[model samples]
Target: MLKKAILLIVLLNGLSPIWGQKYELKSIIFEGNNEISTSRLKGVTLSKESPMWFLQFLNSFSGLGAEAIYFDSSKILFDLAALEEYYRNYGYFEARFSYRYELDTSNFNANLIYTIIEGERSRFRSTFFYGLEGIPDQTYASLIQDYFNASNDWYNQATLEQNINNTINILLNSGYLNARFDSTIIFRDTSANSADLNIYISKGNRITVDTVIINKKGEGASLVNEELLRKITGIEQGSYYNQEEVKRSQIRLFRTGLFNSVIIIPEQNEVSANNVNLNLDGNIGYMHELSPEIIVNNQQSAFNIGLGANFIKKNFFGEARKLTLSTSFGIQDIFNVDFDNLIKRFSFRDTTLLGYVDARATIEQPFLFGKPIFGTWENYATIRKQKDYNITYYGSKITFEFELPKYTFVNFLSTYYNIEQTKEVYRTNNDSLASKLVSTIGVDLGKSTT
Candidate 1:
């Protein structure tokens, strides 16, 4: 069945045999490269997911996943350049790399061998900051301290770029909309392999927002209420031009599910002095998503088949609300593999009696009572046959989730369940109460946000 499944997918996927372009990678060997691992580089290289050794051996004799990975010399040059750029980003400025490939035309296979020589690395000597006369002395000092703390002995172009951006953001968030940085990298004692960084801070005039405009991509899409947008963004006229606040507003609004994409831009005022307004275009509206589920079991004891469907109504109420209707049915051990007559407890039932059915409806609301809290309510019913008894269950659950600091969430759930069983499916006379009422409460920590 595994072979048949693979063959079926391949035939339908339109895989054709093309000569001279089909060869699997034998091995990727690297020498004199020490800073980075081969596995990391291979992950970036063009290769399909690695199969087990047995699969490779099988492919050597037979054609299994034969078209998965084929060698193309055209991509090797780009990959080599990518490897060099990767090393340069890691402070290996003087790294030299070259590659050689050995291919066997008879067997249609190849081996890649790479040689590399990494030279001495450049380190930081001293950092000098200037032109910060406009910024408050205390603020400038704090920014410098933060840069030093974040660097912590690492001297690379990437780190310096990040440090500079962070410093600029600090000033921009502090209401300095026109702030700019004059920076340079001076190699200090190249023989000693040390570099000096000089960043001249120009904290331009502090500014304030003069206006706020809310515009939608479509003429009138009722995905989000205008009042709600104003409140959630927390941006208004006469407010400071705070970049952090703008970013937070973006996150908060995007979280609402009202927009598929969001971008907030600040436009400087041409006539008004030290004043700017914001322009944001949101791609808004609702979408209907259909998801399918499939499960297969070939094990003797658990010869089962399950099929399910989920119809999700995204933004059901013109907000970040979801209403989902789903159903699932499973055929469990229909063939009665374990034909145990002595111990019927462990025996499998007939095909009709071995099945289970489930149905459910759920609604999720991300913002409850105008707060950043998630709430969900679910109602469900299920029926299953075990041995000769028919068991039925009905339940409802209420869940509330809250977002916390550092990408963490806490969830609280309360459930009520009612279950009953009967020996005869058609008559209620043989029915017995399995459970009158079962209530449960659970608290989950570190839940996901999406």
Candidate 2:
């Protein structure tokens, strides 16, 4: 029994050596057949010794069955082909791999050849639009053409969708309220190796104005009186609303200077036949203005002051216009001294003091790009008394001014003056007429920070 057990142990030990003596990798031959460099492949594998070759060798058996352990030249070629395919999907179509296996008495060495061929870049061929109706054909054509020309180089799903959204906004501002577009996009590949895109849009409806209403508010009363409101409404109760008319009316109301805020809302009147109702609300506030000035000269220093208040009303004659009525008061002081020399000798000296008051009325129209053009006529009479003389001056003047791009200017002006003087025992009267045409051109040097 002892001899039989010893023989069994020896048999089991003899089988262990055969099981442990499986296939061991001698060397790895990397056939680099790719646009990528052979150095890059080496960097990826990074296995210089034979013992480290097993892990990388296993990767060569991915699609093959697990039972196949020994890798031949054909198997290495298959693995390199797989790697080349991986690079092709990433826009590197010209990538290729070639291998050289050098066998020695006891080991093997691998030399890889990677050939890369970069091809022409691909781009989008055409962009198309469809299903857009109820929108102006000219506008649609211009927008799409412009966007295509601007974004020809950039091809992506996100950019295509953004272009559609921008087109929708343009329609909205042009008074198209019911506009929509589908996100579905179709790409057509042609024989020329280019892609064309087709987009579908749905333009729902076009809206128009039918009618408008005006509402007024003030601190203690209505901004526009009931009678004024009645006159300002150019349309009847059932007239079709006009956007141009509404805009004109808003400008007129703003020119009044009485309203601090104005809002125009277009409300749809379902009961009326295709008519839109507009609500205009205005908030009225007081009009306040001030003019103060100071002057210094060799003879005398003087100060002049003025204050004004006014009320504004719009559409006085149902023409969507504004009319303003204003009143103002001003005061001034002038101190003067006179010196005389006769034959190099002092002869006489005189000093005087004067005071005056002025009142006027004016009519004006609002203007764009400059100050408003106004027609003003005034009448003034002043009383003045000096150390040796007493006088009264009266006159009228008409002036017109316009604002220009480069400078503010007085286009035309005319003035008439009459002076009546009295000295102790003598009285004299003089009348004069004068006119002036003034204008100026200059460059504005100020820069805008906003």
Candidate 3:
């Protein structure tokens, strides 16, 4: 009994170190996968290799960086199955996957390798679409020509599904709100290595906007006019219901800054309904805010620091109009002076002080003259105390903004007219002053996908 007990203790000691030691997954390698990329295969697997050595080294001390991925033996089985499934999705029905692992006991790291035997890949013999009879003739033709003209192409299930989704989106935007993917049929011939694909879509009754109901919430909601909100939403009562357009409308309302939260819900009583009612619920916050800002920038190759404040009024005078008043003062070349002397340089008598001051008042309206174009008017005054000269300017600007339809080359346009009067005084000869008046007009165009 004493000898047996000694042997058990010795065995426990020997296994303790191996059980507690951690083994990181150093790398994953794929071989014989010529048709598919190795990086793509890696994405489909559950096992993940550790980050680079330097990242892991830094992560050890901070515990917040990219940490090492420790090896898990149980995930290998799932990884093999995932790789095989991924191959089948790519039309490699006869593909086979096998794996082997190498463990470095000395460094406590592991390397996993996979070998893929990709057999004959299946090609598309015929593709067809069904139950698309009621759509517009142009739309139907576009769908068939763009998506289903895939005879003899490699049979890729991923690409096939993506095309189906895109087709459904076209239908949805065409006022078929209840349109959806129904089923997919695949007839495969193993001997010929070909497939016949069929996809069906169930497009319900085309829909139109019957009415729009506004529900206001939160404090100061009553300050926003429903008509102005409707104009900003861009959803009309008698227009065809479009899903993508509704999403865009919701985004526009959020951009107005009048609402803290915006939700536009399209509701239909039945699946086959022909009309949808849009319900717009908005949560409005305080109508006014006074906030301070600390500004830092490198302007004209010199670091500048400034302090500013703004007073904003939302839904000002109704109609979703906004008013903002702003002012700021900044000092240039801050780094060239000592901290103790920085505050002393603010005196107007100190010619060595290089600073600037600005003040502005701006008013913006969501729409102009009942049209979709946005408008803004601003008046500003600025004073700059330079080393050689001191200059002052008074200016006013009028700007008109237009949002163009999507898919166009230019999605946004802005045109402005600016007028300013400048007065300059030389520091060397304080009595010598120059005055000028300037006026300018400009337009800007931009494109955005989102």
Candidate 4:
């Protein structure tokens, strides 16, 4: 090993000479930053990066992934422009920036330092509303007064978009089916460095669904149940337009993982003149994937290797159920198989488990008993062998991966475990021991949830 290390060192040193070179970045330092931390600014800069300690040390041997990086002048200039733009967007228009560097000749590495000066933040001076003459008094009251929690802090662009969506929702639920927003208008106050915002609301004619259709696309694009789809939609011929219900129903449909795309389109009903028709059109594709896997793990005290294949079906039997099947052949501590030195020939043929074979299969139904509770029923079965110990493990489990209180999910499983042992050494019952079976069944409301 010593001779090999010397040879490796000679080969590395003899190839090239790297004594004096251009300055490369070793560290970056920031000063005068108060509101934002130095790390946040570094996140957006594409030029400089801080290397991890262990990776930097490893780079000394052979540089590889996630190793040290050097400084580039072009990237530094790009980062400067990006930082100024970031400050301007965050209401720091008068921000100032400068940088300097310190170099070390031993390794041709340098430390870069940046200085920041953040100025006063801009605020929204005034807000106004228009185009609400046709809306009801209560609707209008809900719109301008309590629709937003606009504090006296710095202006945020996200707040404006949220309020606009809120206005559209309110108008839709209040029988204004075709409500929309006009272009936002802003006026800046040059003297005080503040701005004014105006949002115009348009409430169009109220309408109801004249007809509803579920159009599926792609091969094998069948729903789990037509009745289930209709029930989830929760829209009827004479039902009033409710944007909240539409949004909620769409989310429930997407959670099933059955469709690749879902789109809700509403069109005017010219014949009826007052009602509109909606189409819930989506596409579901046939899915079948199989892949081979080889895994080897070597640790301080143990080694294990396995060869396996995984098979998956996204929609099982066209019912939106998912099935996963996997099988493996594993060997653990292959060099330490039980043996008798008297007979040098291997004893693997005498039921002395030199290796083990394992297989597992599981299937999951996302919606339990066809309900919108965001729950699933999963069944799993697996078998393993401990050849050297003269024992085998066989087990099957039924699990309920379901939503708990207020939209949280938990996994609860019940398993039946069986063990088989070779009777050459001792005599014992072949019967297996498992979780106690409860044959009788009854509904327990407190223990069960939708």
lDDT of each: 0.69, 0.46, 0.85, 0.63
List, residue by residue over 364-443, the lDDT tens digit for candidate 4.
65555655444333333333334323334444445443333321243222222222322222113343333332232222
| Candidate 2 accuracy as TM-score | 0.38
lDDT of 1 by residue, 1-450 (tens): 999999998886654443435666667788887878988887765533336567767788788733236567787787778778777666666778888987777676777877888776777667787766676766677577756675436457777787788788878877788888876755555477666777777877778897767787642355466656666676767887988778767886786556778878999888876888887768775566688999677544778888999988766665467789999987777575454542454433343436678999988876677765667888888887655566677778888765454312443332233333222242243544444556677666654444
lDDT of prediction 1 = 0.69
| Clashing pairs counted in every model | 0, 13, 0, 0
User: On residues 35-62, what C-alpha lDDT tens digit does candidate 2 reach at each position?
Assistant: 4455455444333223344455665667
**Candidate 3 global TM-score:** 0.74
In model 2, where is the ten-residue run with the lowest total lDDT?
A: 418-427
Q: After the best TM-score superposition of candidate 1, give how far the Cα of residue 438 lies from its true spot, in angstroms.
A: 6.7
TM per model? 0.53, 0.38, 0.74, 0.48
Give all candidate RMSDs, comma-separated: 15.4, 20.1, 7.1, 14.8
Supply candidate 4's per-residue lDDT for 386. Answer: 41
Q: Pick the candidate with the highest TM-score.
A: 3
Write the number of the candidate with greater lDDT, choosing between 2 and 3: 3
- Please list the residue runs of candidate 1 whose C-alpha ends up more than 4 Å from where it truly belongs after superposition: 1-126, 131-142, 150-154, 172-181, 185-196, 207-212, 217-220, 234-255, 270-273, 286-320, 328-353, 386-450
